[model samples]
Every structure is written in structure tokens, then in C-alpha cells.
Target: MNKKILISLATSAVLISSIYADTTSLGEITVTTATKTEKSIDGVTASVVVVTQEEIEKTGASTLDKILEKIPSINAQYARFPHPSSKSKASISLRGVGANGTLILIDGKRLSGETESPYEMTRITASMIERIEIVKGSMSTLYGSDAIGGVINIITKKIDKNETTIDIKYGSNGDGEAKNKNVNFITRAKVGTFKYKIYGNINDTTPYSISKSYSQVATNPSTGSAITTDAQHGVTGVSNVTYRDESTTKTIGTRFENDFSDNLKVGIDVNYFKENREGEYIGTAKYINSGTPILVKNTPVSSEDKNSRLDVSLDLEYFITEKLSLDTNIYRSYYKKRNYTNPINFTGPTNTKFSANVTIDGIESNLKYELNDLNFITSGIEYRKEKRESSAINPDPSSSEFITKVVKYKALFIQDEIVLNDTLNATIGARYDNISNADNKTTFQAGLVQKLGENTSLRANYAQGYRAPDIAELYVVSPSYKDGKRFGAEVIYGPKTTAYDLKPEESQTFELSLSNKYNDLSSQLTLFNTTVKDKIELVSYNDGTAAKYYTSENLDEVVIKGIEASFSYIFNDSFDLSLDATYLKTKDKSTGNELMYTPNISASIGANYQITKEFSSNLNFRYIGKQFTNSTNTTKANNYNLVDLGARYNINKHLQFYAGIDNIFDKKIEEELGTNVGRYFYTGIRVSF
Candidate 1:
């Protein structure tokens, strides 16, 4: 629709809005991700789920993954990577899509990480988060890349009062055993015209071992493939192994801001995150004999790692006029990761070392204008530059150990909103992105929302998706060094990813949803589907010699369809219940096969009971249906279910005590090569002043 027509429609709606505007409740949650400006959730045509502070506190969970797992639409799973790196750690998936497809943000800024997974979950505590706004659909028109699955915007705590808090917790796998521990400190105060807030958190957790020894390993009866020992060691049959991994995270952050005048404000924020991880993985020798299956003989690899990241940001805002405002942000992030691995009684490389460093710098400026009470417009420009350096020292020094990659990106985006009628709204947006490595492209989105009555509303949207190639996928080089000159050994080179050889992934996504809010019950149902072309996948190529290398290549197509349903009932101030479920169907149309690591069915149900204001209890249950781990569908990750229980008590205003048990039934599942943790218990206390 054109601007003139949209404005006229909104003007008519404003006139009619006077008839029944006072009959509805005035309280509505304001969201920023859907419109890039604070507005009521009902004013947007997108689907958004808000995890409020009250919800976070009642979950009794310390980690973001555990807290999000109870949401029906989230496919939250964390695993140990077969190939170790800073990026191979904990991750979160949505709607059965891979974690890499989802874009995660903190306070409207990018949180840098490996393209494979997000490893920053343990750095921040739940107490540091004020709320999380989840936008479930394509948002490429606003955010440049990696928005095919969805967007998660985490809003951190902003202190409204001078306060200090101390939180501590201890956890275990079973009775009288220690497994996890956490401690956090937070404080905020106002001095003169400046306000400041600081936070510190420390988390430590022991390892979880799926199997005790190689003797306990066996083959899969369904796929006719080995389960425990094959995917880990690249061996076919034998089982002779033991596995253990542990992690520790330490984080500290501070935010300082001041208002120079009533029309302008400035702020500076900084954070540091450090993590230590170590693990031992054992497997059998390679299977060369011509037999049905091989055997494992207890050969293993042990590794230890140290990773750290630093983030610094500056914010500026000014009121250019009464109807116009400017917002600008600049951020820089640096990541340093190093690891050492050694083979034990194996016929592989010995004393191998791998290290990587990534640096990212970004800047963005946005201008918002309110044309009238029913019209809002926003325009922004963003630029980002990233550099990656990876090095490895193998048992053979001549194999080469260095690779560097760099990328520069810029984007321009604009969005318009109009209140077409008292019960109707419309949104139109577009973005143009330029990448140093590939052809520039433009994307667009349009949506509509209509309120049928005080209790019902409908939403529909169509959007475009875009994703640039990852650093590991392109611009990689391995120059074999013998006396710092070209040697006899073959040098591995990444395949040049041209617009045709490896085209940028393009997708079209659509969603339709209905929501209802009654006296005591609220429900939402959404149907979504997406079609993608030129899907990217890692492919191996021979360097026309003994050496082999890998690069990403474009696949034919992919189709995904899914349904999400959620409902909540508040019986009173003392009792509340919620249930949600998701069913997904996805396929790699080129191969006529289901996508990997996507479950067909998943759901979560929970209830909260409060006997009094200071005493409360909560119970939650989650289930994940069967899924495949391999492209051929020969390997499987069996279905699993888990239950959790928690309770909290307050002795007075300054003292509180809480306890929680995760995986209450001791449920365990062998995902691919590693296993999920067992039952864990924790107790803690909080003090606030």
C-alpha cells in the first residue's frame, strides 16, 4: 500500500477508536524487536513471546538454555562437539531449525560467536536479565543476516532504584553429590547526574559421562550402525571408551550512563567473559577388516581449552526535534581461544594445538519520526567489519598452521507503520545489504494485523531471508611451509565461493497466527512455512593429491513447515498453568530426506502454585520426540522426557531461600556421541538491600 492511502486509512481508524478505546484494559507489554521502537505487542503483525522477569524468577533455572527449554516452540539442546572449538559448545535451536539459523541479540547489539553455536549462555545469570523478547519469524528486513529461523532479543536488567543483591546456588546430580555451583553479585546506584550498574558471576560445573567404558558400547539395531564409538573416533564397530567434559565460566560487566540535558543522553558499557573447558574422549582403532562390524580397543584423545571474550560499547541519543529523534551505537568485540589435544594409544596425530582469534567492530545509527498519532517511520544504517585468524600445529609441522579471513559489511533499512483502522494495522519494510565477498541484495517484508474483538486477533506476514557465508566457509588457506617457502607438500585451498559456486541463501517465509485473551485464559496458534534455495552445506574436496580440504557449497532447496500452539490459564493469584506444543515437518527437497537434528514433536507443560506471597512451588515437564542425527537417516537420537521441581521461601524482605531439582527422574539420552546430563539438585539463598 502507498503512504497516502495508509495514512488516510489510519486517520479514519483514529476517529473510530474513540468509540471503544476505553472499554479495554490499558495494560499491555511493550516490545521493541517487532517494530524497532517501543510499542504494544498487539500493535505489530508479527508473533512475539515475552519471557518476563517474574517468569524467569519462578523457573528456578540459572542457565538461559534450561529456562528456554520449557517454551514449546524452542528446540533447546546442548551438546559436545566431536571436533572441539570455542564454537562447538552449548547452543539453542528454534522450531527444529539449527542454532546457526537463529540470530541472538543483547540490548539491540550483536553477540558475536562461532557460526556453529552460541557459547555465551553461562556467562550471565538469570538475575541479570529483566526480560527476553522472542520474535518468531523472518526479520531480515530489520536485521541483516541469520534471521531465517527467528530472532531472540535479550533485554538485561536496568535498575530503577538503588539496590544491591547477592545470589548463591549449589547443585548436584543425585542425593548428596556436587555437580554445579553458581555465585553472582549485582548493584546499581545513582551518583549526581550519572547512573551506574555492575554485575559479576561465576559458574562451575562438573562433567557428565554417558558410558563408563568401551565394554558398555554397542551397535544400533534400527540404523544398523554403531552408536557410541563410530561418530566420535571415525571408526565403524568397536567400543572401548570413556568420556568426560567439564566447564567453568566467569563474567563481569558494568554500565554507566548520564543525561547531559533533557534532550540528550550518553552511555558506555563494557564486559569480559572467560571460560575453561577440558574433556577426555576415548575410541577404538580404525576399522579396516572386511567384516560386519569392528571393535573398539580403548584409544582416546584428551584436550584442554581456554577461551576469553571482551566487549565494549558506546551509546548516544538526542532529540533532533519534538517529532524526530536520533539513536547511534558503536560496539567492538574480541575473542581469543586456544586448545591443546593429545592422542593416547591411537594411530593419529599427537600433541596437536589449535587456536583462533576473532575481532569484530560495528556501528549503527537510527532515526525515528512520528508523522502523526497513527503513523511511525524508522530508518537506519549499519556497518560491521570482522577478522578471523585460525592456526593449528600438528604432529607434522610441515602440514601448515595459519589461515586469516576478513569481511566488511554495510546495510540500510527503513520501516513504516500505519494504523489502518481501529482493529487493523499494517507494516512495510525493506533492507539493502552489501558484503565485500558477494553480490549486494535487497530484501522486503509486509504484514497485517486485525483485531476481531476485545478477545481475538489475527496476524499474517511475509518476509525475505538472507545469509552471508561464514568465515570458516570461505577465504581459508593452508600453505605447507618448509623453510618459509613453497614446499613439496600440497597446500590446501578453500574453493572460491562465487555467486554461482556458492550462492547466498535466499528464502521466502510466511506465517499466520490467531491469538485470544479471555477473562482467565489466553491462547495462541500459529502456522508457518518457509522455502529456501541454494542451501549451504559443507563439502569435502581432494586437492588433486593426498591432502583433502572442505568448503561450503550450495544445495538445491529446502522446505520447512510447522505449527506452534500455546495456552495459559490463571486460576487466581495463587495458581497458574501453561502448556505448549510444536509439530515440525522439514525436508531437503534435493535429496527427499528430512533435515538433521530436527525433532518431529516437542512440548512443555508447567504449573505454578503459591500458598502465600513469599512461598511458592513450580513443576515443569518437557518432551522431545524422535530425530535423526545423520543426513541419510541411518543414525537416530531417541526420544526423551524430563521433569523439574522447584520451591522458594522468604523469611523477610531481605532474606530468601530457594531449592530446585532438574531432571528429577534421572532421565538420560545418548544424543549422538555424547549424553545429556543426569538428575541434578540445587539449593541457594538470595539477599537484597
Candidate 2:
């Protein structure tokens, strides 16, 4: 049978079961995207996934990447532990789109240091989050930029006076561990309402070893020397490298919320983070050839990075009438960051990027009115201004570069939700943004939801989104050196040529979804299509001789379409099972070819059984399909499957014992990169109090 026929049969079976079991409870939790105020997710005509605190703990995820890896349509990658550039940096690719297209928000506010790279720079601690909400498809009508792929909003924990907790974890295979302690204290009867939360975390890792394998190097016809690096395996005349890294990050924050009256609220928040990381490189022997051992070298270098941000915000909510309300908020953020590296040449160059500071101020207001029992509308306007100063020094004075950037943006948006009947609804929204670099743009969205039964629903959405280049991409000035040679600074230019020359990236997305629930089963399936114009791509230029220079440019067009499905079934009282699958096919329409690094199929299966009231066991199987590294698809990656098994034994109410094995099959598989391979297994335990 065809795959489409199979999907239709499965969907029909689930919908039939759900229609018969119509007594299933409905979700009451509200969302903020579809409307200015809180509204039920069931009423929103879009695909959404919510990961709550309980779900986060139940999944036993150690980091943000681990949890995202489980999502059916989301993809992520990390270079290594304690990466030099960004500790919290992880690429968040949705469907077949790149990471740069996804928009991320923290506590309803944009990230302080959002840069315009194909990757994101988010640093929120996973343990400190109260919930994570994922909105799939285009959202330009809600957010101005980076909403071409999707939106992910992380809500932090609210201050609480009742409880405090501490968590510590340890693992194997040079996999470091982390200790997190958080306490929330709140006071309501004092001179002013005070709510404060403090968090401290420590992570440490041992050295990891990578064996070398001998291979033929691509020869350079001109020099008669090797053009590529060669590694030897299980032999002499080679360099055996072992890597060790450790990082400690501490964050302290407090929020004071004052209720001046029933219609006004004032809030002040301050947050600071101090991050220190160190890495060690060890070589058994640096040999040029047999009996030609040069020497054995070992070096340890460290860097300390710091970031601080203070936010002062005020909000006022007034009831204009019984059916109308006015909401307004104003905020200012002061940000600073610094990175200090030891005097060592790693990656063949003495690299450093230090002293980046920015100050931002923004204000927003919304007017909401209820026309009737089944209709409502919301209109809002927002304005923001940011000033940034940065400098990069090559330690040689003449090779240094400096940058100063100022940007201002303004937007006006309106949304309307109409409930045609008890079983039908439609929503329409539009937004217009005026950017300093560019004139202006308008994006729009429309969605419809139909109720098939009490426990089953169908939704479809279409949206148009626009994204402008960020400050980093528009005005960055840096220096680069030639291959392992400390030749002075090589000129590096920003993306902008004449300030307003580049066109804004625009996209259109269409999505259809079905949700169903039965007594012991719940499932959701989605199909999405996205087309982007003026897509940005990096282009590399070589002088036809020795070195290559890289810059960014706009592409003609691209289109991506994918399907995602998830199912969960509860069997009896002690067992449960879940299956999730995703299939994506992306192509560059201008070339009529598929895009690279976007797999065709990926899936996972999970099962859990309760051995006893206090003891439970979990098993998971994960599969990743093959992908390519280059647009031309000259190179290919091998697919691999991995298994994870774990158990939890509760000692008492105050303690628990848990251990899990990652990469249990010990499969040696190369990722998208042909030369780099990842294969390892680790076991970790977690303690909570």
C-alpha cells in the first residue's frame, strides 16, 4: 500500500475512536499568540506544542538540546562540549529551514543579544524554565523578524515563597556533570511587593580522546605538498589529541512587582551571569614520520566570559468599559558582555572577540474589545531602539577593528477572531513594520478551525512573513588570517553595501493539522509547506590561488514541505508508549533540486513501565536518516540508530535514584561531516531534593 493510504487509514481509525469517546476533558490552559490576551489553545487555528515542568522532568532531559532532539520536526547540532564561541549556542532548525529563520522569545521579550547569524544565541538555563511553547508555521503577523520558520517562547519560573530545590547530575565518557541550586522568595506584605529568585550552576568535564586514522591527503599540484590534513590510526608517526573542558555559570536575578492600583503594575528586574571555561589539549607524541618524533606537547588554556542585563518595566491595564480594555508596557534593558582568552594560538590563530555592549528601550500598547459573544478584535503598536558598540583587537593594534551600530524599529498590528458557530472559527491578522535600514513591509495571516467532534478537530493556516537583517549581520567588521599563517588582518566586510540596498527576506507558509484524543490515546499530525524569496546564503570567494573569503548574499528562492506525526497510548495503569515521526523534503526552486543536510525521514519510539509504585523503567529507540553536507550533495552521511534505557527508584519522598545510558548500541557513525565521527556511550545519575 502507498504511504498516503496508510496515513489515511490510521487517521480515520483514531478519529473514529475519538468521536465515540467524546467525554475526554478539554484543555483549559490559555495562549498569548492568537490573541493579545490569554486564549485557549483549542481555539487557536495553528499547530502548537507545550512542554510543561512535569513533562520536562519526566523526559529526563539533561540539556536543551536533548529535549529538542526528541521533537519530531526539530533538528539540532553541537560541535563539542564547552565550545569556545557560545556556551548556550545551539542551532534550532525547524522542518527543512535553517536555524536563523526561527524566532525565540524569553518571558514575552526578545533576547537581549540576538545576532543575525544562521544560528541563535540563547542562554536560558533549562532547569530554570517554567514552560516551553512551540508555535509551528509562519508568524510574521505576530513577530516582525525571524518568524519565517516558527516561534519558540520560553517562560521562566515565577517567584514562589513555598519551595526551594537543588539538583545535581554526573555522567561518564568525559561527559561533565552539573549542579543547580535555586530558591524563590516572595514577600507581599512589605513596603513594596518583593519577589526574588537566584540560581547557580556548575559544570565540569574530563578529557575525551579521539583516535587518528591514516588516510591519503589530497595533493596540491602546485606545491607537491598535501592540501589536506592526514590522520593515522593505530600506528606511530602521528599526533594523538585528547580534549578536556570545564565551565561554571552563575546567574542571580530578582524581580519586584508592585501593584500601585488595580489598574497599574510596575516591575523591576536585574540579572547577571558569570561564565568561566577552561580547555586542555594533550598529545602523546608529535611525530613527523617513523623515528622522527618531534616532541610531546600539552597545553591548558582558559577563558572567562561575563554578561549582565538589567530590565526596568512598567505595565498598566485599565478597563475602558465593561467590554473594552487597554494594556500598555514600557521597558529598558542595559546589557554588557566581555570575553577574555589566554595568550595561546588554537585553530592556528590567536582569536579573540571582546567587549560587546548594547542598550535597548521599547514600549508597546494594545487595545482589546469584545464585540459580542463570538467575536473580538485586538490592535497594538510597538517601538524599539537599540545602540551597540563593539571592538575586536588582534593584540597587534593595527589589526584591530571597531563597530558602532544604531537601529530603530516600529510596528503596528491588528488581529480578529470570529467564531462563526459552535463548530467553526476563523482568525485573520496583519502587521506592518518600518525599519531604519529599510522602508517598510506588511505581513498577513489567516487560519480556520473546524470541529469534527467533541474530541477531534481540524485546522489549517496560511501566513506571510518578512525578516530584516540583524545588527551583527548588517554592520559587523572583523579580521581573518590565512591558513595557519599569522598574516596580519584580512579585510572583513559587513552584509550591507549601501545601508538600504539589500531586500528583505520574505516567506509564505501553509499548514494543516489534525488532533484527536480517546480514553487512553492522544495523537496529532501536521503537514506544512513553506516558500521563501530572497533567501540569504553565504558565498565564498577564492582568488584562484591560496585563500578564500566568505560573505553573505541573497538567493533567488526556495521551498520546503514536511509532515510530522506523534502518537501516545496508555495501556492499563502501569505502562505507556509513544511514537513520533517526521519526513521533510526541501528544494531550491530556482535550481529545481533538493536542499542539503535535511533528512528525508527521522523517527523515535519510547516505552515506559512501572515496576512498582516507586520504581519505573524507560526505554527509547531513536533513528536518524542520512543527510548531505553540501548543496551539490557530493558527500553523504551514514544513518544510525541508538537506544537508551533507564530506571528510577525512589528511596523516599526527599530522594530518588536514576540512571540512563546514552548511545547504548555503541554505533560509530559519521554525522553530516565526512571526516568527523561521533560514537560514545554515557551513563548519568540525578539527585533531587
Q: What local distance difference test score does each model get?
A: 0.70, 0.60
- Pairs clashing within candidate 2: 212-232, 213-231, 213-233, 214-232, 214-233
Kindly report which residue pairs in candidate 1 clash with one another.
214-240, 214-241, 238-294, 238-295, 238-296, 239-296
Candidate with best lDDT:
1
lDDT of 2 by residue, 484-549 (tens): 111111223222113224456889988898878777777878888888897765434444553333
Q: Candidate 2 versus the native: TM-score? A: 0.80
Q: Estimate each model's TM-score.
A: 0.84, 0.80
Candidate 1's C-alpha lDDT?
A: 0.70
- lDDT for predicted candidate 2 compared with the true structure: 0.60
- For residues 1-689, write the lDDT of model 1, one tens digit per residue: 22243234333333343244323432388999988899888777787889998888777767786577677667754432324322225566666555656888888888665555555555557878899999887788898877766788889888577999998988777743336788888899888779999999898877654333333223331121345545333333332222334778888999999989989999999989898877665422223223433322334456677889899999999998999999999999888877665544443443322467788899999999999988899999999988777654122222336566678989999999988889899999999999997789899999998887776678899989888766544433222111011111122322222322457778888898766666666666778898878776544444442223334567688888877767677899999988777777889887788876778777778999997999999999888777776667788888888898999999899988999888888998664524555787788998999
Quote the lDDT for 313 in model 2: 65
Over 4 Å off, model 2: 1-26, 34-36, 77-89, 114-122, 159-161, 174-198, 203-245, 258-265, 279-322, 333-335, 340-350, 392-398, 475-501, 668-689
